[model samples]
Structures are given as C-alpha cells and as structure tokens.
Target chain A: MATALENANLLSRAILTTQKLRISVSKTFNHMKDGIKVSQDEHGAPKSFASQLQEDLFLINESFIELEKLTMAVRRQREAETIGNTGALSMDPVTDKTPLYPKALETYKWATRLREHSAHSQAFLNNSSIKRSSGSGGSPAKRRKTAPTNLNISTQAVDNLVMNVNRQFHDVKITKIQLNPTVLQVYVSRTLQAIIVLRGLLIERVLIRAHHENTLNDDGTLDLWTASKYEVFQKITEHATAASLRYYLPTMQDLSFRSFMHWLNSFSKLFSTPCRLCGKYIKDNLPPTWRCFRTVEPYHECCRP
Target chain B: MGVTCVTQWPVTENRTVPQAVEVLTKRLDALGASKSGNFGVDCETYQSVPTNVPLKYIHVMHNKEQPYTCYAVTDNRTCLVCENSFEAIMHRLNGFYVPKKTARIESKGTRYEMGDFIIKIGIVSLGPHARGVLVEVEYTPCVIIQDCWPLMVEFMQGFMGAQYTPNTHPMLANKQEVPFNAEDTVFQYLEQFENFVKRGSSTATVR
Candidate 1:
C-alpha cells in the first residue's frame, strides 16, 4: 500500500510539472511572437530590415530550444503516468536523479533569459543604429539640430568675406558692406557698388557698376569709362549675360557637376532666339516650348499656338 | 562729442527783446566772449497729403562754424548730418514732403569762451517778433554729461545769477550718466525748438 501511494505521488508531481511546462512553453511562444512583432514595428528605416530578420531568426532558435525542452518534459510525464497505471513499484533511477520539476524550472529560467536577452539587444541596436545614421546623414532630426549651427557658420562666413573684401580693396574706401550668407553687397567710394554671390570661394553671379555720374579721378589719371575697373566689370557683365550665369549658380554646398552638365545639355537649344510670330526679343524667363514648332523662333505665350 | 545744454532765458522786467540781448551780449563781452558766426535752426513741418500717415517735419539746422555738414532732422528724429545741403535733400523729396510750418529761430550774439565752458546768448526771434533768449552752454572738453554737469551749472550760475536756476533739459535729465554724442546735443536743440514752436506764435513760411 505504501509503495503504491509513493508511485501515485510521483506520477501526480510529474503530471503537474508537464502542465506547468506546457503553460510556460505556450507563454514563451507568445512572448517570442510579440518580440518579433515589436522588432519589426520598431524598424523605422528600410535599411534595418535585414538585421531585424537575423535577430528574429535568432530569437526563433532560442524559442525552439525551449519548445524542445517542454516536449521532453511531456514525454517524461507520459512515461511516469504509464508506469503508475501499470502499478509498477520501482521508479526509473535516471528520472529520480533529474526530476521533471527541476528541469522544467531550468527551462523556464532559460526561456525568460532568452526573452530578456532579445529585448536588451533590440534596445541597444535601436540606439546605436540611430546614432550612426544621425551622425553621418542629414535626417530631419539631424537637420533640426544642425540648423542653428548652420546659421552661425554662415554668419562667420560673411564676417570672413567682409574681412577679405576689406583687405582686397583697402585703397578704395568701402562706405558700407552688408552680407547675408549667400550674397555680399559693397558700397565703395568713387560711386562704385558691387553685388556678389559666392559659391564657395568662386564668384558665381556678380554685378559691379558705377551708380553716380562718371567723374574724372582727382589726379586726372582716368575717367570712369576709361578705367580698368570699369572695363573688367563690363567684361564680367557681358560674360554673365552670354553664359546665363544666373542658372548655373547653386545655393547648396555640394555642387553636382554631372547634374549641372545634364541640365546644360537639356537647356542648350532653349535660349537667345527672337520670336518670329511676335517679332520681339525672347527672354529665357519664358519656357523653351514657347518657340514655334516649324520656324524654330521663340514666341510670347499669347502668340504661341 | 561734447556735452551741450539748451535753456530759454526769462523775459526781463522793463527790458525789450533786443535790449535783453544787448545786456546779455555786454555781459558776455565783459567775460571776454567774441562773435564767431550766425547759427540758425529752422524746422519745416509737413502733413502727409495722403491720409493715414502721420505728420512729418524736417528740421534743418546749420552751424556756420561747421560749414561742411548740413544737420537735417527727417521723420526719423535722429539727425542726419549729411555732406549734401538741406536744399539738395529737400529737392530730392519735393513731391513727397511739402513744407507746412517753418520755425525761423536764429542765434546772433557773442559766444563766451571761459576755460572749457563755451556760452552763447541768442535773442531767439519768430520772423519779426523776438520771442525769448536762447542760452546754449557747452562743456567742450567733457564727453560725459555727469562729469561736466556740475561745472556747467556753476558757470551758468555765475552769469545767470540766483534769480534763475537752469534745469537740465528733459532729454539730458534721463541720460545724465551716459556718454554724450552729437545726437544728444542735436536732440536738446530740437526739443527747445519744439517747445518754442508749441507757444502758438506767428510762424514764418520757408521758401
């Protein structure tokens, strides 16, 4: 009677262990599914998808190991039940050494540890990857942080420009010089004013002209028209107008030569033609297709068919 | 650059405007002051013909001593001492600003020089009528108002006597501790001229 009762007690304990393992296994599977969903959802960038998939695979392997342990527990529980039903007095010595409850506890701990590991790795990866992305590229978040710094840089650049201009034409007194990032305006003595747009160190678009009446110099060295400064300014103006330097100027720091060349090629035939229909000068301000189809002459929007 | 104070002298008992000017001149001459040149500060008020915009005035004050610059006060109260004359600037803004009232306040008297203090006693006139005496005392060496105010008061007291105590003009009253500028001097003159105009006397037309 005592042996039968002990066997029954062992069987019940095994059954209880199996039930707990089953519950824990189901819980682990649910938690793993949730973790994968969380990782997938947290992937804000498309480039992180491959790495997220690898993490998901790793988590699934851990979950499979937990599932395997739970299945082995259930098999042991079945064997113990069968042994108890057959009224066998002696228990399996190996089973007695490693009880179902202790092994189930171990698997449960492993499952929880795997879950925590996945969560910790996900959090660490999210932070490190975000830092890497924001550090290098101009994401909206990164751009917002750099906006004030960009303004400071531009103001400093303007200060540098004024200092350079002062050094360049120290002989000619500059009455006033104003700079707002891209454009630098100078009002100098001798009725000369210059408006300059700089793309890096290169002068992209510039207009230098005499505002007042052309007076002879105090020493009678040169008149306004005969001055080398006037000649150089005129040459620059002619070059700018002929080449259409206005369109060539880029406000951004990085100048893509290929894109600029492509634009030049595209817009090559779309300039400097007189309108046949209206018999007026065609300005580049209007569209290219404003030219007549057969005549190859530009026309006003109203005059064009 | 130096501290300048403008004050109106009280009309004396049984003394005509010219007589008062004469007495002040004699006193100035007694103190070893000499006639330098005539100085005039005239203001031409202009009301905008187009409605909604406020009335604007152009005060053109020319010091014969400083002949190179014409100190013209446009709508912006700040004095623009331009190289161009008042006539040139007025000609440029002819259509925009039409002259309404002209305050013809002229100063013709001895400029007393006693140490750092320079004093001018002018019988300020309104066209034909002599309005009052305009006394201008300047501390030539002092750029700070607080440092020079006491010395200026003492000098003025020596000539003005105990009967009249010269109060610091409203403009200088608040900015006593601050470093003086050319604008502060101009502002004092403008304020005195404005008060003289507000007395509702006969105003002359500026040609």
Candidate 2:
C-alpha cells in the first residue's frame, strides 16, 4: 500500500512537471505582434496532431478487422479441436497446432494491409486534381447505383461468419457490416472490442473531452465522450480477447490486432470479471463506478482500466 | 470526436427566462443575497443562459511571442479566452453607460495619467433587429464596489469586511472581483483590456 501511494505521488509529480513545462514554453512565446484572421483552418489544424491521430486510428481499424476474422478462425480451430479426441475447449499447444490456421494468418495480414490501401488512396487523391468530398449536396435518391460483383467474400461471407461465430461465442456480435465493390469494413463488438480501443488510448481522450463539455450549453452540441465510451470499453474489455484496432500503412506503422490482443490477453486475468457486462456467467454484485441500471450483467470498476 | 472543440463548452440545457425570475425571487430569500426590497434584481426576460460568462470583459492582446495571451484586449485570461468568450455578457443593464463611440473627449477635464488604468464595459444589444453593436464604456465606476466584474482568473483576494478569506481551488476563481496584479501595472492591463473589447465586438457577429 505504501509503495502504491508512493507511486501515485511520483506519477502526480511527473504529470505536474509536464504541465509546468508546457506553461513555461507558453510564457516565453508572449510578445506583441499584429495579426490578421485570414481563413477558417486556412492553415489547418496543427498537421502533426492530426497526422498522428489519423495514423493511430488507421492501424487500429485494421487491427479490429483482423480481430473479427480471428474470432471466426478461432471458432474454426476450436471445431478441429472438438472433432479430434480432445475435450471441447482443449487443444494440444505443441503438436495439435497444425499450420497456425492459414485463414487466421491471412486475416491478420489483410488487417495489417488496410493501412497501406488507405495511404495509397489518400496519395491518389492528393496527386490527382480531385477535391475531397465537401458534400454530395444533392438529393439522396439521386445518388449513383451499385455496380455488379461476383465473389465468394461477398456480403454473404460476412453474414455466414457472424452466424458461425455467434453460435460458438454467444457473447460476440457483429454490430455493423459494410460492403463496397472495392473496400469493405465490418464493425463487431462484444464489450471486449471497446475496451481494447480504450486500452489503446482512444476511449480515454474521448471520455475526458466529453466530461468537460457541459450539457447546459444552449447550442445543441454533444460532448464526444459521453457515458457511452466507458460503457463500450468496459464491456469489451470484459468479454473479448485478442481484439484491438489493426490497419496497414505503406509509409507508416502496421499495428496488428491479434498481436495487441495477445499482448492484452496476457493481462486480462488481472481484471477479475472481464467482460462482466456481456458474459453469460457473471456474479451479480458490481462495483460502484461500473454499476448501470441498463445492464443486468454489471462490470466491476476494478476490472476497468 | 467532436466536430469542433469550441462547440462543446459546458452549459446547462433547457433554461427558461421565467426560471431565472423564479430563481432570483428565491435568491432574494437566500442569506446574504440582499433581502431588502431595494436590493432586488429585475430581469428583462433573461431566462435563457447568456452565451458568455456574466460580466466578463475582453482585453486586447498584442504580445509578439504569446500572441494568444498578448495584445488581446482582455483584462483577464478567463474573461476573454475562457470557453464562452464570444457570448453576450449582459442581456440588459439598468445603468446606462456613456457610449465610447460618438462621445467627445475633452482635453481639459482629464487628469494627468500615464498608467492610471480604467475599465471598459463591452456590450451588445439587439438594436432594431439582430444587428450587432459593440459598445465600449470607460469603466470608471463611481466606487470600487461597483466594479463587480473582475478578470476570470486567480487574482489576489481582497477583504470582504477586513477578514482574511481563503479561496479554494477549483472555486471558479475567475468569477470573483479583484484588482489587477500590483507588480503588473494596472495601465498595461487596461490597455490589454481595451483591445479585448474591440476584438470581442468585431468577432461577436461571427461567433
């Protein structure tokens, strides 16, 4: 207990030092100058901040897509394990591993590759004379019709995958499925996914900003991180495993979802009732912070990061 | 993420002017809130929340290095730079202040003043439709007590009645009335304050 308290004190001092440094830097920059307001973001948000945020999300998005695929792959692996003379959940780590499930590796790689496609697409946009989408500025009914497609990885594949995965893992659910002739994105959540995003720092920023946004403002603007972020992350952290954001970037870092999950799962046992919100078997009592009138299977505050 | 950081300022939702009237009526009964009949405040349908903090003044800033902090005509950082800097401060005022615009300044009556700081009250009124007018007042309040508005920041505390009072942290320190820092001459602050009022008036329409 004394060590924990000492650590907390040290952390506070470190945080204060950083804040003071920023303050000191700001103090130095004060000098009289004439200026003009030229245009709205005529210069744009500090490019550095925007680029970092965009890069992080791009990799995370791929990581999530891969994690979705891995959930299915694991179900497939579990199927093989079930049929082989082993107990339902049991698989021989050394010999029974087989070929690392070719589909899982493919899914992981595909997830990691998405960042590259995004970067190339962005480059293509900048290189060409085409302007970014300001808005469609037309009636929705007048939009272009869909093109034809013939492929096994059609919308049907997603539906089948979701059905198969959900049948095996009752807690998991594919919340959204998006399909384009070219790029496809699927959003799946089972409480665990949201937690992974939070662990990656997305949810914390969103929630902190949301808390500061006062609801009393006359303007009809909602804070970015309402109760929903905590709810989502806490739920995901408890139920899902090896789920995180993943994407590929040709010119940048390629974050892996499975790898992050594998990393996170190593620590999941620390949370006493991980995925308490969605898990079928969870004790009734919940911690004060995580108590929700909405969810019957409540997560403990201690379990949340 | 929120589309814009500025848009997400804290505010109470769904307040009616009549609610303010009722609240004021109750406020009168509250201890130390002027219970005398003469001490009552009247609202001109001021039920809705003002877009900016009440009594907040803007200062001009022109500092070269910290442009955000310098040359701003804001008297206090919080009054001008705080979240709700662009909103109407006072919806209605019973006391009429002389408009700085079109008001003649005499060369004789003015006393020698190199650094004697004065305040400026920037106001916007709904004149003949929603046309915005930025009015500046040379905040020469008759008495120090009349200067109810102060920079919305942590300034030195003054005695309420000769007793020392401790200001708590997270106490919305900017809301209290206090004079400018003694070390930082009042004249410099006033100059900064004037610039704030001008910028606020110009930006009022867009904001």
Candidate 3:
C-alpha cells in the first residue's frame, strides 16, 4: 500500500512536469517575439533577450528530464507490484479496486479461447479434401475460361426481363421502371403494390404497400422508403423479403424473377384468405401475411408455427 | 383511421337498456374481445338565437379516440373538423348561437379489441337518461369500406347475430369505394344521436 501511494505521487509529479514543459516552450516563443524585456528577473531587473531565451530553454530541458525520471520511477513501481502479485493474482493490484481489471481479464481469456478454436477450424479447413469445383482446383487461366460469363447484367437485359415477366403474369403489371438506382413499381392484381430495387441483376430490396396506399410521392416519383400504413402490409413486406431470398438463383435469374412474381400473385387473396391453421380472418392485428414458398398456402405469421 | 361502421342496436321489449348492453358485451367477451379501456363521444347542439335568421343546428362533437380534434357537423351534413380549441371559439359565439342544454347526448362505455377489430359497446344517453345502445366496429387494417366490409360483417355476426349485424350503413353505402376517414366516423355517430333524439323518451330510463 505504501508503494502504491508512492507510485501515484510519482505519476502526479510526471503530469505536473509535462505541464511545466509546455508552459516554458510557449514562454520561449513569446520571448522570441516580444524581445525579452517583457519579463523581469527575480531581482526586478529587466533581463536581456539572449539570457531570457536561455532561461526558458533551461526550464523546458529540466522539466522534460524530471518528467522522464518520474515516469521511469512509476513504471518500475508498477513492474514490482505486478511481479509480487504474479504468484496469486495475474492483474495489477491497484486496478483490482475497480471492475476494469477483472472485466479486461475475462475479455482477454475469451479472445484467447476464440483464437484457439478458430485456429483449429482453419487447420481443419486447409486439410479437408472437399473440392469446390474441378476447374477451381486447376490453373487460374483454365478456371477463368470455364467460369460463367454473364455475371454483370446489362440494362437492356433487365428491361427485357421486366417485359417478359409482364407478359407472363397478367396480374403483375410493371407500372414504372426508374434508372440510376433501378426500381420497379409493380401493381399485383388489385390487392397490393410492390416496389423492387435492383443492383446489377440482383433483387436488392422489396417493399410492399396496400393497393389503397400510394406507392408514389406527391411529385409523381416512385416512393421507395415509406412503408405501408397498415400492419398487414408491413408484415407482408417482411414475408416478401424472405420470399425474395428463397427464390434467389444467381445462375437462373429469369426463373427466380418469375417465381417471385408467382408468389406475389398469391397475395391477391390477402384480405380474402383466412389462415389455414386457425381459419380466422385476422390474428394479432394482422391478416395472413405469410404465404408458403412451395404450396402458396396462406398462414398468419403466428399460425405458421 | 380505418373503416368504421356505427349502428344503433335497438332495445327489445323483453330486455332493458343495460340488459341489452350486457348481452352484447357477454357475446363480445365470448368471441375473445378483451376490454382495453373506456371511450366516450358527446355532442352538444347549438342553434342560432335570432328568430329572424333561419334556424340552423351545429353539432359540436368530441370523440375520445381523437381527443385532440373537435368536429362541428351542421344540419346539412357539412362537417368542419378542427382543433379542440374550437370549443372555446364556439363559446365565444354565444350571442349568435345559444346551446340547447336539454339536447345534449353522449355515448360512453367499454372499448374492446379483438384481433384487428376495435369494438365499442356504448350506452347512448340523452341528458341524464339512457336511450339505446350503439355498437361501433372498426376493421383497422383496410381503409376502403368495400374491401373490408364483408370481413367486418363476418366478425360482427360472430357476436351480434345475423339479424342484428346490419348491412352496409346508409352513410357508407355511397362512399363504399372511397377510403374512409375520421370524419365519416363522426358523421355516423352524429346521425345515430339524431335518431335517438327523434325517437324521444319512449324507451329512455334513468341509469
């Protein structure tokens, strides 16, 4: 405890010396500008510029040296404490008074354990004989030649896909398609309106609003951010996102888009269809928002479970 | 703000006013409706004082659901929805229009929630006497009455019986295709209050 108090005193002295060093440096600059008769010596005689600069430089040097010595003393004291406590406690005895040391120790141990597990997993992955692709295991040139080419879809292809889907699904009408950040405003039957955002060829985001709710802003631009006012459509938005993910097939993009449209068309009976399980029109202040990906059967979010 | 249908549930000869309310509430509770809180809607009728000027009644009303807004509906079905401070403005016009104190009517009772529907079973009272029962069923998801009227009818009939479950309310019939607003709800309540006034104290009893 006595050593701890001595170490704290050394730290406080180090901080004071740092402040002293800063003050002397600023005074040296002030003397350089003001020509050094600005301050008087201890005997009340005006000091010469050269002597005042030397005095300020000497003060700065002395404070810096004191600060270094005090920091060294504090470090030695801390090292001694840690060495003494190493047999019983692995952390600093001073920091043990607060929760900081134990919490840090816990975090360190957790990180070490995680690192060990990750190392084992990495070694196992490296040693595993599972080949992802025959061409992927070969030379880079051959792999590049074998890989599929149409990864980045063109704007014309997206327009063609929209037109083809519109022709296939009579209920799914592509009302507006905006460029830059590609967005499609779809009117599905008379039930709901959907906004689909695209990145390259991929469906990035999907939002569903009820038919009565406006899908466009007052200025006649597609409104992509505002969610449906009704809870039923908000729930439908969640299900629609999940459906988008379910139907996502990178290689078969056209099929994926078509399947998504077909699933969305099932929601034409959203308000009309009762939950298959509970056989009720409403539950938890929402209609049957979830439709089965495969069967297209309607179920309330709760009733599905 | 959803589509709401307010209708008067007449008190039969066999059952009194409270008895009728009790029966309806019991049916609602059995249909899994939980009492959320109490709601009240009151309307005060004001008429021009001068005999020379044509008499026009302005019904200044307040609904508990929309506590911040006051609705003043005229005799010709023109409604002006404004801030609750409109009451103070009406009081300032006392020299031109005098309030008919005896014509004050209010409906206050338990509000229930069942699924997406909000059902209010209120006892309609004129002055100090209970006149009838008013049931307001609101399907809170769909705004257009035509879209959700059938669903509301099915739910209402689960407790109110097919005979009592009214067809599309007359006020809502013409505007079925349009989105229902809060004004339509207030107007329906005002019409029901007027009906109770015309029916007089024949079935009224102090409660």
TM-score of each: 0.37, 0.16, 0.61
Off by over 4 Å in 3: A1-151, A159-197, A204-231, A273-305, B12-16, B26-32, B50-54, B92-96, B201-207
- Per-candidate Cα RMSD to the true structure, in Å, reads 28.0, 35.5, 19.5
lDDT of 2 by residue, B1-207 (tens): 110000001112455433433432342233123221111000011122345445433332221112223222333433333222222343233132112331111100111111111211112222222112111111111111112123111011110112323222211242343322211222233433334345556877788
Chain A: TM-score in each model: 0.21, 0.20, 0.51
| Residue range with the least summed lDDT across 10 consecutive positions in model 2 chain A | A201-210
Worst ten-residue run, lDDT, model 3 chain A?
A: A78-87
Q: Give Cα distance to truth, residue B116, candidate 3, Å.
A: 2.2
Clashing pairs in 3: none
Task: State model 3's lDDT.
Answer: 0.81
Error of 3 at B168 (Å): 2.1
TM-score of 2: 0.16
Could you arrange the candidates by DockQ from highest to lowest? 3, 1, 2
Ranking by lDDT: 3, 1, 2
> What TM-score would you give candidate 3 relative to the actual structure?
0.61
lDDT of 2 by residue, A1-305 (tens): 45455555655655655565555444333311222223344476443534544544555455455445434433222334323443322444554566444444466579779988999898787566432222223333432321111122355554454455445434333232223322211122211222122212111111111111233225663323233333323343333321232221111111232233233333222223334544421222221224322232344445433
